[model samples]
Target: MRKPENESRTKTIKAMYTQIVNELRARILSGELTQGSRIATEYEIAQQYHVSRGTVRQALGELTREGLLERVQGSGTFVRSSVHTHEAETSLPAQKNIGVILSHATDELNMRLLRGIEQAARSRGYQVIFAYSEENDQLLARDIASLQMTTAGLILFPLSNRSIDSTIVRLKQVGFPVVLVDRYLADMDNDYVVSDNVGGGYRATEHLAILGHTRIGFAYSRAGDLRTTSVRDRWEGYRKALYEYQRPFDDSLILADLPTDAEPDTDLFDALIRRPDLPSAIFAVNDWVALEFIKAATRTGVRIPEDVAIVGFDDLSYDEHLSVPLTSIAQQGIAMGMHAATLLINRIEKHVLGEPKHIVLPTQLIVRQSCGARLQVLRAPDEKPS
Candidate 1:
């Protein structure tokens, strides 16, 4: 069970108060709250932050003095429009350039997102400036800020492990236009477009359950993955499906922080071959993770579906070509890109001046031979794959 919100709020008043200030300030400057947008009531704010109404009022008072917000006697409080105009005012007119920062450039994630972004940007006669952050280097945020300097707005796919940068905070404070793709910061209100990871996960797990596999495993690449929204949401979906299907949620069935290598002695690889009552089916965090699992299991003489089954997220292009075509969930990357780019452009062009938009595209399950859907090779829970 999770601790009550008030339980954690006892840490420090200064800490909580300042944190609320920063969060609200980010929303205001990021154009999430927007100029003239009425913010939550004091009671609402107090409840949200699990603080006293007096503390909420104090925070609002500070913002009011800073000229980010104003009090309307009958209507509560609102973000100041003039502040948005003044802070976001650039001497030059908005540029026709859109900046894009992605995690990888070689995969279909690139191809699809770019295709959608290009299609939308082209319609508006905007040029795209692109960069990738495969190394997860310190220079990433700097590169994005630099891109912003050259373009009218930005579309970003941030590295999961990295914290929000001071530069990003400054950009939002100035009401600079940006739209996040794939994932978003939980504490900050930023416009974003993402796939329905939780729903996708539930569907994937449910598919395995429907196939008569009671023992299912979930694979993740890192111990810190739960901190990442996509991974956490998917895991939540897995648990939800387990509950719905009346399957036990077993910790031993989970394989996490797996070595990012193919060498022997890997926990995931060795466990499948040596462990008794190994899960008859597996749900991988993503297609790549699924592929790795398949390789490891097959190398140890585990027959696909006939012995064990596997399902993965992200129905990648090559899934169909593998010896065992992967059954997976598909994300609308292209649509995500289009939505993000278009939203950013609208903000840049002053077409939208309302609250931040969070768009979640639906996910689809692509069935193949790997999940044992057609093979019907489910074994008893106690039986070992042979």
Candidate 2:
């Protein structure tokens, strides 16, 4: 007997589903889908491919597991993050390639630094392979291990909280060419390049003091723990600068654990600023945190520079774009990255080089409208000869 039309239709649907899935997979792998683009939905796909909804769902499920598509709870499906593509490129070459290990690529500071590294690497005929960890100690260790096997040289941004001295020591013992960025292990002999964090912090505070502002606030995440060298250095600088100004350090003015994860906290900032004895000025550890202060202060009807001045580290892209642009300690991210990459490449080329070296770069204070020290808003303060 011949099969019924419904039975034939079922078999046809299965075949069409397979074809659709293969086509979509190919498009994603070839970079055709693109990051942040929405993939076709089950209903749309079912209509287009002449397949049942069940068949479409099955196809999407397979790709989602492979990290190709992401299914949001209520917002519909999207292409999964693009970090895996960087992982795929890690295996390409040794000499012509350099590996950049970062904590988070989505972070503004990290992206700026990576842009610098990419510029220097491309000009010098080198390709960059980037790997990012979510600041997890174990995942960071794995990333470091992967770099050792795949690339010619390594540039790492180490996890801040946990101890990784042993791992750094092990890499050094094996004669690996590594340049640490932003963070460094205590007393470790590994070659590293970092900003003059202490000096930057001191200058930010000293500048506030010179303007006749007392009771300044220092804001940061995990401020007292001193998990990383930068945090410790900044805190030390704050103390030193206050001491020089003959201002008594008040523990109550310091704000810690201000939600540096993903986004800044408004309520926390509000509480800090609402204090009866509010800080005349605040020094933030980075630009993101400074933006938070600006937003929170504005919401509370506080005027920038007039009520509370603000300064930030890492002069970021949007710093100058704000209504009241921010003052910041300008870290030479591109120059630092270029220098670190060149050092690593040099070591890779000179295989006989015996020991690693450390390099510290200088930082500059970029005065802007936010600090109340702008040339136009206030009278000029005499500059001390350098």
Candidate 3:
């Protein structure tokens, strides 16, 4: 039966809008559009899909009603912050699934870790679900509770700001198969995997000391405290290296109050400038903070590796491309992720018995131009300028 032109066009438009809505919903389910992330404007979506603005608006409106998106006046639409209500209404498959809860998901380190986990899970025929905690303890607790309903087991990167001791204890009491990664709670009995932070810190400090740096300083972000597992371990390694080198420890050499926010704090640099005697070298807790210190030092006319050498933990990809290539401790994030997944899966399948497994991977030092080691090599008479 042939329909009128107006009726045919109306049906076609409705089909197009329905397709758009389904596509957007699929993205949300696939984790391509994360919670609280901004989505494209109606105009942008219409242009991309070659659809009318009305069609785009209709599609977005439907998603908003379904509790998948929220639109603000004068601002763009965003994914809803909470997915519990949506998940509650949806029917999930009965297939085996593993849940991963991380403090963050966007950074390079975390992405690599996710890759390793996904690779391992795929080989084992298990689906992987991800939840971002943003280092919030309350959010982490909620995510754990939600994932517990559907997933077979769980993997977690514990928050540094607040302890999840009570939550983990509860999970343990329920006999949930769980594995901890990156950070661990001291009093908890859980399978875990972590990098050798103390060894990395010691090696970084020792490298500077070996390079004839007597006055060495330690720099850490204010986001983490001395009680934090990773930070405390690194600091202990620094102290151990100092003792081994017979170097005197000076409290003034520690710069432990750098701002953790995205915006730079000039006052932190001011403290460094006002010091009567600047340290010959600085060991930053991580690569990002090391780069921040470099930027601050440059603003104050302090030349890196000349006036003050610098070393950092975490050999991030961009470290080599920096103005002064950073010397850092290499952490095997991907390996750690794979190991954590293996541990969790084994527990879930009952392949591992008896006590929980705690694995601490080794770290290595990656030397670059920032630590003055390259300068020494270049200055040698037998060495050619590569």
Report clash pairs, candidate 3. none
Give per-residue lDDT, candidate 3, residue 256.
84
Name the top TM-score candidate.
3
lDDT of 2 by residue, 127-180 (tens): 777777767668777777876777787888877764456666788778777889
Model 1 deviation from the true structure expressed as Cα RMSD, one decimal place: 20.1
Judged by whole-model lDDT over C-alpha atoms, candidate 3 comes out at 0.79
Worst 10 residues of 2 by lDDT: 377-386
lDDT of 3 at 294: 78
Q: With candidate 2 superimposed using the best TM-score fit, by how many Å does residue 376's alpha carbon deviate from the native?
A: 9.1
TM-score (C-alpha) between model 3 and the true structure: 0.75
- Looking at model 1, report the run of 10 residues with the lowest lDDT sum: 84-93
Ranking under TM-score, best-scoring first?
A: 3, 2, 1
- After the best TM-score superposition of candidate 3, give how far the Cα of residue 188 lies from its true spot, in angstroms: 2.1
lDDT of each: 0.77, 0.75, 0.79
